[model samples]
Target: MEDSDDFLRLILDSIAENIAVIDEGGGIRFVNHSWSQFGSDNACSITQDWSKMNYLSVCDSAALAGDEFGMLAGNGIKSVIDQKEAYFNLEYPCHSNNEQRWFIMRVSPFELNKERFFVISHQDVTERKLAEKAVEKLARRDGLTNIYNRRAFDEILSEQWQQCLTLKQPISLAVIDLDHFKLLNDTYGHQIGDDCLIAVSALLKNFARRTGDVCARYGGEEFAVIWSYTTLLEALVLSKALLEEIRQLKIPNERSPIAPYMTASIGLVEMTPNRILETRDLIAQADDLLYQAKESGRNKVSSLIVVPSSAVENQN
Candidate 1:
């Protein structure tokens, strides 16, 4: 029995992850060498004679402190100890002053001589977590302007639509188009055109300050903004401000009649939950209004608030 215990401790010390064994009573039975080193390296105030510290008590303290993740951890640990769950796993950030870190906590229950014990392991997963974040960032962002991509914008619109449906709030969308952009592109070559697109995208992105606000490349020389919880007048004012900001860019477009510098037009629609559910209709309406902006002469904004009674009744 003694030799077996020594072998187990030796194996635990060899591994990297911090490992500890806690009994059913929540008493810390044992902690491996790596566990002590982790606390020392992180300047954790937890003592080496971990028996003096109760894992369950730490979780309870965290929960009382109103840490959501800590509450989850406490619940997960209880589930394992009660044999209600096979194992508990949680990935969480534990950044310290010296280093940004993330860890994967795993708790598995085992029985020896009819006595229950839970093996807790903490594995450093910072590199993997950071890499995953980088990949996710790339997936959701536009390559050109480093703003949300069209796909992300669509996702946000769908989410906001659902929220508005439930809360009966208003959401607005604005379609922005560069006037005579094709002429500018044809005259100055694609490089300058690309520069203009980047600059304009940056400007539009800056306008998305509010939560759930999304600015995306709708298509070539065109951008779109989804503004959640906005009224018709608010949408119109924002669109007009965006139009003015684009003109202020002052990128010369001699080929256009609107101005010596570049200009953009905006078409906006503010819809409430008591309106049609067809997001496509909203886009089409905005597009039609954008055509009107171009026809009425560029460098302007056009907006409308619409409600389809039939859809509103269905929604109700």
Candidate 2:
């Protein structure tokens, strides 16, 4: 009987699935060698109890069990504890060797001690998940500026509005226009004009170094930036600095009818909390400010503040 038990153990250990025998009470009774080698505990589970393992704490069994993937794995361990049949697929994201990966898991129930136990199996599926994400990113990103496209910008701004309202945070919007851009195109030709756009796009991205900050080309010779969790003063300072940087571009616009150098004008506005401002209203305010900067004189920055239910007001 001892030799027969040892032979059975060897066969179970040789199979890929992590074979672990647990009592009806959810304790780690026995673990196969294969199971011990690949489980996510970093080899800390050789002599450790399953209840004490760190990986189980963060496991989202509820989310996994109800989804299609989870259904394939069988009832989750939770069901097993309740003496009910369960299955699930557990996706574990792991970081190792400076790379990230996901392990697809299968968990099911079995009989042990005349009660109920569970079996969990997993396989690495990081490559598939990464490929899907890569495809999604390529679809969402703009080919020219590498920023979010207008469609993405529109959707994200709407989402940001809700987030700001919920968090009671401030939001800001800005409109940027190239000074004498038409003449630059006529003189330097469209090729150099496109280059100018790329350069300015890079500048805007550099200035918007926050998680919720978004920059995009609104259209020809024009761009827009959305700033979340920022104040009017912060937005104004950023616009001023960016305007100055573009003024100093010195792109050799000698062939243009305007200034000998290339430059841009900026207009921005901040949305305070508790105000009911629409995205269009924010955009219109920035556009009006852009015109104000252009009318006052080219190559400068102008900003305005608009109360949700009131008219536009000038900010110092």
Candidate 3:
């Protein structure tokens, strides 16, 4: 019987997942080698001996300290222990200072000698999670410029619009078009035009360093930027700076008119979102302003603030 128990322990230790068993009262009953190793590697407080610890108490402490995953894991384990749930599973991030990591925790209940126990296992799922993120990024990124694509731009704009609406903050959008880009492509091969787009996209990325800022390839030689919590005046300042930076790139545009170097025209709009207005209205207004910039001689910013009808009526 002792040899048989030793063999079972060896098999459990050989498994890669961190496994542990707890009694009905959540008292740690046993833990496999992987569980001990993981605790030691992570410098966990429970590395010395888990038998003296209560698993549910650890989760409760984490919950009190504002760990949502802890609260969820505690509830899941309790449901399984109470026989209300046959099994429980959760996926969560547990990133370390050195690298990002993900793990899936699974809990299953069992009975031995008429005593109920719960077996919990945590499996690393970082590789699969990273692969999923890679695929999602490719779907949202432009192949040529390596910037967010038009679809991503639309999604980001709509999301930011909703957030700004909920916060009652201002959101800004910029519609930028390269001046005479078709002529530039026609004059100096498509390769040069592609290179120019790459350079401009790289520059635009610098301005979008903020949490809610997004720069995307709108389509062709056009690009869009979404600035959360920004007013029209603030957007105009940045738009003018962007224009100068693009001109500073000095990508030769010896095709026809407008400076000897490449230049761009921008249409900028800022608005405090309201139920009466849609995201499309913001785009439309910015597109119109962009047209105005082009018509008024390219390489400048035309900006406006869109006031909802209710706000205008309230002002009167």
Top model number, TM-score:
3
- Cα-based TM-score, every candidate: 0.80, 0.72, 0.90
- In model 1, the worst 10-residue window by lDDT is 307-316
lDDT, residue 186, model 1: 86
Q: Candidate 2's error at 80, in angstroms?
A: 7.0
Task: Write model 1 residue lDDT over 1-316, tens digit each, in one string.
Answer: 6569798789889999999999987889999999999889768898558898888889889989988778888899999998899999999888888778899999999998999999999999999989998999899888887777878877878888888878888888888899999888888988999999999988887788888688988888889999888887787778878888888889989979878889988888778754446677778877877887777887887777777653211000
TM-score, cand. 1: 0.80
Candidate 1: residue 297 lDDT (0-100) = 80
Q: For each candidate, what is the lDDT?
A: 0.84, 0.73, 0.91
103-196, model 2: which lDDT tens digit per residue?
7776567774686666666666788999988988877777777777777778888888778878988788888898888888888789998888
* Candidate 2 regions with alpha-carbon error over 4 angstroms: 1-25, 39-76, 79-86, 90-92, 96-99, 109-117, 155-163, 180-182, 254-258, 273-275, 278-280, 291-298
lDDT: which candidate is best?
3
Worst 10 residues of 3 by lDDT: 307-316
